[model samples]
Target: MTKLAEMQCEACQVGAPQVSDEELANLIKMIPDWAVVVRDGVMQLERVFKFKNFKLAMAFTNALADLAETDFHHPGILTEWGKVTVTWWSHSVKGLHQNDFIMAAKTDELLISGK
Candidate 1:
């Protein structure tokens, strides 16, 4: 199977299917650093990336923005002094989708690539 980071996100529509429990189990393993969280009754994939300082955090946030723009799938980003919390979910489906996992893996790649 193709790695999540190598997979391109497909256009998600309002009736798109959410990831199944089996798929979520497998995908979550690929992004172990991220947590499966429920906020306001919505299931989301979230992770807090640490940086040395505010500047670094902002830089990472900007890089993530570029990725989101390219995929046309945005995340909820909380940037702070030394950390950035990213939350991925498919608003169109009102739940978690494969794109969220793909983006989460790519987000991890940003750190690995030192973006």
Candidate 2:
């Protein structure tokens, strides 16, 4: 089976179908560390990675920023002194998508690669 991080994000249109219950269940397994959240009534995927120092945190953030630009799907990223919180959701679809899960997995991949 193709991993979530290995799946490329397709262009999500305004009326694209969000990941359904079954899909969410499967994708959730692919990215177990991510927490499903509802903010302003829209579903999202979030995870926070702990770091030992500010420099490492910023490095991860910068890497994610570049990845977001490359993927054309940006995320809500907060880089703090010892942690980076990443929130991924499809603003166009007004909820989570397969892309969100894919990006979330990719984020984790980047974190591990950086270490």
In terms of lDDT, which candidate is strongest?
1
- Measured with C-alpha atoms, the lDDT of residue 15 in candidate 2 is 98
| Candidate 2 Cα errors over 4 Å, as ranges | none
TM-scores for all predictions: 0.98, 0.96
lDDT of 1 by residue, 1-115 (tens): 6999999999999999999999999999999999999988889999999999999999999999999999999999999999999999999998899999999999999999987
Which sections of candidate 1 miss by over 4 Å?
Answer: none
lDDT of 2 by residue, 4-115 (tens): 7889999999999999999999989989899999999999999999999999899999999999998999999999999999999999999988999999989999977873
Best by TM-score: 1
* Model 1, TM vs. native: 0.98
Error of 1 at 50 (Å): 0.5
Candidate 2: 10-residue stretch with minimal lDDT:
106-115
